[model samples]
Target: MTDDRCFRIDEMDLDELRDRTRDQTLIDAFSNWIRNFAPHVDEVIAEISAAFANNKLRDGIGLFEATGLDDYASDEELRRLRASDEKLDWKRISTADLSRCYCSPSFFDPQGFVFHLPAFLIAELNDEHPYGFIDRIYRTEEHPEGWRALLTNKQRVAIIAVLELIREHPDYQHELDDIDASLERFRGAQSMG
Candidate 1:
C-alpha cells in the first residue's frame, strides 16, 4: 500500500484532521473522523462501562444481536469481541467487524454509539458495502438525544463536513433535508453547549 493508504488515523493531530477532511471523498472523510476520534476509544469505553456498571440497563452493543456480526463475523471473533472489560482497540477491528458493528446502531448506548459510528458512516459512504445504516443516525428512536452530545467539537465539525459533502453529491440529493436538519441541530447545539 502507498503511504496515504497506510495512514493511521490515531497518529493525526487536529491540523492534519482538518486538512485531510477538506475536499475528500465521503469514505475518506469518514475515515478522517474515525482517526480524529480513534485515540478516545479506550477512555470512552471505560467511561460508559463505569456509568452503567451498577445500573440494571445494559451498556454498549451486544455482540450476538449485531446484524453485521451475524452476517460477517465468525463465532471465534464474536467471542473475542464480547469482552467489554478490555479497552476497545479500534485499529485492530476489521472492516467486516465494522460492518457487523455498524448494523446494530440502535442497540448501542448513547455515549457508546461513538464507538461504531465511523463504521456506519464508512459503510454508508462506500458504495461497495451491502447495507445502508445512515438513516439510523438521524432517527429519533435510534439516537434520540441527537449526535451533538456523542462527539467532540472537532468530530462534530468533521461530521458536518461529511453531511455537506453528501448534500452536494447528486446520488444523495434525497437526503438533503435530513442533512440540513441535522446540520442545523448540530450548529445550534454547539452554540448552546
Candidate 2:
C-alpha cells in the first residue's frame, strides 16, 4: 500500500491547507510585507494638512489684528495695519497631543481612527498667541482606510468664528496676501511682548 504520509498535493483542499498554516507570525509577516510594499502615504498627507491648518489659524488671527489700530483709526490705516498683521510665526507652535481638553467623535476618522493633540498646544495656539486663537481642533479631510486629524469641521468652524470675531474687532483687520507673513510677525511680537 502507498504511504499515507506522502499524500499528493492535488488531493489536499487549498482552503484547508491555507487555514491550517495561519498564526500570529504569519499575520505579522503579511502585514510587514504589505507595509514594505505600500508605505503609509496618508501619514505624509495628514502631516501636511496639520501644518497647513495650524498655520491658517495662526495667520488668520494675526492678519486680522496686527495693526494695533482700533475702530477710531482711518480705513487706510486699518488696511495697512491688517497688512502688517498678516505675517505669522509658523514654527511657534508644536504638534502635541490634545485629546483631554475636548472630546468629540467628529475628530475621529469616519473609518474609525485615532489621534491626539495636547490641550496646552491648543490653548497656546488659540489663547496665548497674539492676534487671536482657535480653541478647537479642525479636521479637513478623511480617507477610506484609517487616519484622522485632531480637528473636525465643527471645530474648524469654531476657529473660523474666532477669526471672524478678530476680523470684526474694532482694532482688527484681515488681508489675504499678508496672512502668512502676519503669523510670522505675530510670533515675533508675541515673543517680544
* Best-fitting candidate, scored by lDDT: 1
lDDT of 1 at 35: 56
Candidate 1 lDDT over residue span 1-193, tens digit each: 1123211233344346456556446445445545554444344434433332332213555433354354666776655555542235332345675554544555555544565555445544543234555565544343635434756655555556555555554334567777788778767766665
- Model 2's lDDT to the true fold? 0.32
Q: Write the per-residue lDDT of candidate 2 for residues 1-193, one digit (tens) a residue.
A: 1112111112233234346666655444333433442232233324434544433333232322322232345778756655653233434433321222123223223221112222223333233322122222222222312322233443333333333323322122334223334334334444443
- TM-score for candidate 1, residues paired by index: 0.53
Relative to the true structure, candidate 2 reaches a TM of: 0.22
Query: Deviation in angstroms for 178 in model 1?
Result: 1.4
List the RMSD of every prediction in angstroms: 10.3, 22.6
Residue 16 in model 2: lDDT: 42
Error of 1 at 159 (Å): 1.1
Question: What does the lDDT come to for candidate 1?
Answer: 0.50
